[model samples]
Target chain A: MELKDYNSCVQEWADPLFRFAYKCSGNEEDARDVVQNSFEVLWQKRQEVYADKAKAFLFQVAYRQSVDLFRKKGRIQYTEQPEFSGSSNPGNPDLKRVLERALSQLDEQSRALVLLKDYEGYHYDEIAQITNLSETQVKVYLHRARKTLKNYLVSVENIL
Target chain B: MVTLENYEEYIISYVDGALNAAELQELEAFIAHHPELRSEMSAYENTRLMPDTSMIYANKEALLKQAPKRTISLGNWRSYGVAAGIIALIGTAILLWQHTNNNHVATIVNVTINKNTAQAPVGPIAHENPIKKDKAIQQPVIAAVNHRKQARPGIASAPGINRLTVNDHQNNTAQPSQEKPEVNKPVEIARITALPEPKTIDTISPAKVLTAVITPNETMVADKQDEKDPFAWLPIDDTKKQGLKDLKKTVDKTVKEVRSVTNNLKETALVFKFGKKEITLNF
Candidate 1:
């Protein structure tokens, strides 16, 4: 990887990687920090890494950083949303808000799997590469997460 | 019956596009038969969530501002290192050539001195060592030395043999024995060097020179066959004569080998080309 290519890598991946880090870490500062760390590592290992592998490599690094930052904060397990809203007199319900809440409920790995599959349209294999999980695990975890989201919607619909 | 519990994995695979063509057709056929499972598929499809891209990333510029700088590859350094190594090699070769500019000579002479007190028929002491004025000097034997510290070959640790050396130039040199010799000295000196073989023993050019002999014996006895008195100067008794024959055969072989190896320096000569009148000086 040349210096020019390094700059190109930053230009190409900065936004999507930041988005991934932002979604994983749930904090803008931590996400920025993760993105910075990933690029710094990419800089250090420029010779070994090829241009094609840069995106996967960057995401892999970001995933690890996000996991570490989460673990360091002692937030390994996610604070799941309630299965159904207990509040009576249900008014206007936002599906996007419900989806965000559902996403926030999942643990880091599952959340990353869902984000990679849904938002980025990554294949099971691509998600596996990013999250350091097997393709089967990515598929299974993604399905389980979607089921949970459906369950959230179900609970919200039941309340309605 | 395709129940929801038995094939929920298949349902998920269908929604995620992970199902192969056969599996996808099988699922479609199964759902076609059971329309309720089609609703199950719709439930799965509706729950396929995508995050809001606009809201997810809040600070892109801050991350962009801290981008990476490039590193120089190991390949770049290797070329420079190789170039420096070649230059160093060339420099060392030039320095070595400059250091060793003078003449290169390898000479070895082996002389056997007889312990004869009988002061062999005295004549003009042309090559006599002034240091050993008392000793009888018969013939001047040129025993050259090498500057390089290589041990001279074919040397015997003979007791009671006196050793004297004088670098009086030319072949007028001799190995003088002890002051008072109780027995007759049997001096058998054989020298092999880049110096051309002398034409005859009679015309030895008796110069005012002196030296002792050590050893690299390859005496061309056949080359100097014209010498009427080759072995006459160093008289050998019956025992010494037998030893000389054996020694001469060994010296002949060694001389042939040395000549083959030291082919570079062939008899250092001064060629004087005075307008077609060429005069060669063999040293």
Candidate 2:
């Protein structure tokens, strides 16, 4: 792709890619690094990637980088839970925080599949392409991740 | 397709929006029949995460790529040609300047030597010698004075020998001499004894003739003679000396510049042609 197309991709996809990386990695710094490295890889291979495919290429690179980081660091547990100053009621508890805690419960690959699938609204084949998995595997993995999240939300003790 | 056995898959697919319209309606019917499972479907639907729009890449500008700059590569023959031409032009100019400077210095040295020689006292004195040419050549007055000084030392100290005389017989024999005389004669004798003296010539000691041959006046005249001066070949003017120093400095600077240029050129490949052979130099 040309420089202009690459720049346009940066402007258009940077936020979404960063959000995807953040959700996958669960750390702001790691997510930022993944996003930067993804663009850098995109620039190096700009000639081979068309303008329309740049977003997928960027996400693919980000996915790989985030996975590599996760592998290198092993499993990271979310220890610093945000404090809720008001009611301790499970039904009235903050859903965003509950969902973030739920996302943190899944493994790195499963979490990435869910993020790519839900956040970016990628199809099964597209998630498979980015994650280097078959469509059936993506579907099976994504369903398992969704079930895990659903189970976490269903448990009142876990939510409280 | 929407039975209780496969209902979980249907709910998951429904939450994922993977269900067709007819399949979605069938799942809705199944969910209506089993209304208690609708909460599970709601929980599954809540599992799909919405992206936090507030989270942005703060440094998006860093990823931009600028247009590449044009650079002149020495791989081109035209660049090499330009560099070689510049070096050749500088070399030629320096050679021509040095050639002209050397010629100028040579001309100045020649003129100064000729001018000093022309102003010398030797020419007029030699032509005006009154002693018979054959006798003067045979006696060789310098030798005669040396011989007389060795034979009779007392004559060199005589009052008559020191006295200035215009027509003294000793004066004429000593007048034309260019070498320093053996005896210590007064400067007046050299100045007065202009005509060649023939009277009392046999009575005079050779030391007096030797003493009269060279005087303080002639010593100064001899110092001006270019042939006798050791450093006469050097330029005499201070400005000319400074010019030579400046030329030397220019040559040194030019050499350093050429060396630097060649050093820079070493980064590129160079080709040389000799007869039918081609030699390529790469660094």
Candidate 3:
């Protein structure tokens, strides 16, 4: 890629990618790290990247980086800490807060599926491409993930 | 009754929108008949509207810290190596070149359309230790142009030794005949500049030059195509574009009204209401 062109791409996609990374990792520094690594890899593979394919290219790099970190930390397993207050207090008036806490209770993959589908509003095909899952699998994962979150939210309400 | 275990797959498909029209109808029918499942699905959708405070993973920084720090330094070295290679190649070409050295000198002269222009000094010789004199001379010229392109516009302002020496030579050769007229040219250029023209040096800076060179030709073509096809660059469908245009116009009108009221805040604040509370601006 041309030097100026790459600079423009960084400007356009850096913030959104950082936000995505921040949501996944829950730390600003790690989000920055993911963004930095993503750009570094993008620059290295500049030859393979065309202008139109640049967004997918950066996203793929970031997704892989997030997954790699996730695997390394053994976060793929299902676990939670009752000691923690979770992402929100049980008294928060906003139902959105309740949903967000419910979402965080799920495993990394499920959380990722929910975020991609609901928040970023990716189609099943796009999520499949990014997550390297089959379109059918994306549908199944999203369905299961959403159901789990729904169940978790209902449980929280019942306890209240 | 649809048991939760038997209906789990359908619930997922229903939320994910993978179901066909008939399937959707069936699911809706099931929900209509089943109050408990309907409540469950309502909770599912409420989860969608959740405020996302997802944080970037924390240990990612520590892991990245564990990785080598030399990547940036390595990249810098790679670029430096490529640049050094290009300089060496051009250096070799100059040494091997047998003729046409004067044409090269003339091309340098041709660059100055305005003869009396106060040219900046040429920069330092790029190839520090040249194997040959001819190569050394040519290397500076090629590198100067390349450097100018990459460096800031003001970088060449600090004239170099080579430029000072060249200026001395040009003064001796062309001085007597053109000296008077040349002295007056800067004054005339300065006078023309002083005129109250809307477009001046500020307007013709490198940014505008680059924009004129690049954007307009492409934009002109796009505009021509757009005249025949209105939705060319727009992502919205034609029907949607019409709706969007009307919406935009309405928004603009409302924004203008709001802005006008804001601009007259002191006067308008007398009548403004916010729920049960009302406040007045003293100014």
Candidate 4:
């Protein structure tokens, strides 16, 4: 990809990648950094990247950068905003809070697989490509992530 | 019968729709056999937490606005490199021109002034010193190095110093500085022949122009006198410039009686008669 086309790719995929990154890391600032840095990596290796596979390649870079950021910041706890407090359903804040906390409980790889699957609707193979895992690993890890979420939410329900 | 060991796999595959029809019926029968496992199935089924697309897309539009739109190309760089190369080549060409202009030595004349045409041929004067009788005898050799324009037929230019302008013998008395010609190249030696006595003005043959050979040792003695002032044309440091000025002042005070042989000399001509022919030459 040329630099011109890479900028276009940024315009094209920046949001979706940001959306995924924001979901993976619950911080908007970190998400933006991850997206910006991913685009930067794509720019550096633009010669090797094809325009067709640019979206997948960008998401992968964002994933690794997000994971690195997660490690660098230690075990990141999601800080929920006041705007995320009010919801259409009366009980949604609790469920969403429980879900966010539960998602943070998973390891970085498992959280990445789950976010790639649920937020992006990627297939096991696509999630595997993004996370550098085999399809079986993606499936198994995503299933484990779902189990953790369910257990956390269930315990929250039991307390309520 | 779904056992506890693989129950999680059966439940996950069932939720993922990876179970075949018989395995699905069996898992359904097993879940129906267990009631507490039903809510666990519901929790897993509804565990997907999606990012709000509207809020993220709004953020995306703002981020995209901040990103730069265009990039530099390889073609642009090639043009830049080519432009720099042309500028460098032009710079080198200018420096070479300046060096060539400043580095060359000024041309000096090696004429021997003859006071009397009877003792010397009136054809050309080669050196300024009257004391050097040997140089007066080898006047033809100095004529060759300086190649002064001879008034009559016998004088000719030297062979090697071809790219020089020879001063006429009449004007040789004007500038002593011009007489000490400064050639940039190292001073070299050459064999020269003396002019022969003319048998007849009409029979002054070209073969007889170079008649007698002179020794190189005689010219070396004259060249030692010439090396003093040849450095006048070059740029010098302050110390050397001061030294040259001091030397000039000292020479002006001490060398009053030693007049330049080329200076204050009147133009003298020698007339030769060969039977019916007459040759009047200036010295």
Q: Each model's TM-score?
A: 0.46, 0.52, 0.41, 0.45
| Candidate 4, A1-160: lDDT as tens digits | 8756776886778888887787667678998888888877887788899998888899999998888888787786677656554557665445666787888889888888877776767778887887888988888887888788888888888777
Q: Which ten residues in a row have the lowest lDDT in candidate 3 chain B?
A: B186-195
Q: Write the per-residue lDDT of candidate 1 for residues A78-147, one digit (tens) a residue.
A: 3444544764534746666666666777887888877777666788998888787888888889889877
What local lDDT does model 4 show for residue B238? 25
Question: Mind giving the per-residue lDDT tens digits that candidate 3 earns over B1-283?
Answer: 3455656667666666566888778777877778777777777667674324453333333222222354557885686567656655564355324222211111111011111111311222111112212222211121112112232334233222122112232223333323222322211000011112223111111211110111223322322332243333687433233223323333443455445434554343232234564434332
Best by DockQ: 2
Q: Compare the candidates by lDDT and give the number of the best one.
A: 2
Please report the TM-score between candidate 1 and the true structure: 0.46
lDDT of 2: 0.62
Error of 2 at A94 (Å): 0.8
Q: What DockQ values do the models have?
A: 0.29, 0.58, 0.13, 0.30
lDDT of 4 by residue, B1-283 (tens): 5876777778876655557899989888888888778877788776876666665534444333244667889896687567655654565466445533433211122222222223434233233322223333322223333212212222232322211122443334423245334222222221122333322111112222231112233333334443344445668432233234323332442243123212322243434454575555443
Docking class of 1: acceptable
Q: Which window of 10 residues has the lowest lDDT sum in candidate 4 chain B? A: B199-208
In what order do the candidates fall by DockQ, top score first?
2, 4, 1, 3
Can you write out model 2's per-residue Cα lDDT over B141-240, one digit (the tens) per residue?
Answer: 1111222223233433442332222324345444544343412332222212121333323222322221222232432233233123233357653223
DockQ, prediction 1: 0.29
User: Second chain only: TM-score per model?
Assistant: 0.26, 0.27, 0.17, 0.24
lDDT of 1 by residue, B1-283 (tens): 2355656777877667678888878777888877876766776776666655564444444434344477778896586557555655565456435433332223323332222312332222223322223422233333333432332443222222123233333224343343222123212322222212233211111221222222222223321231333344576642233224434444554455445433523444445444565545443
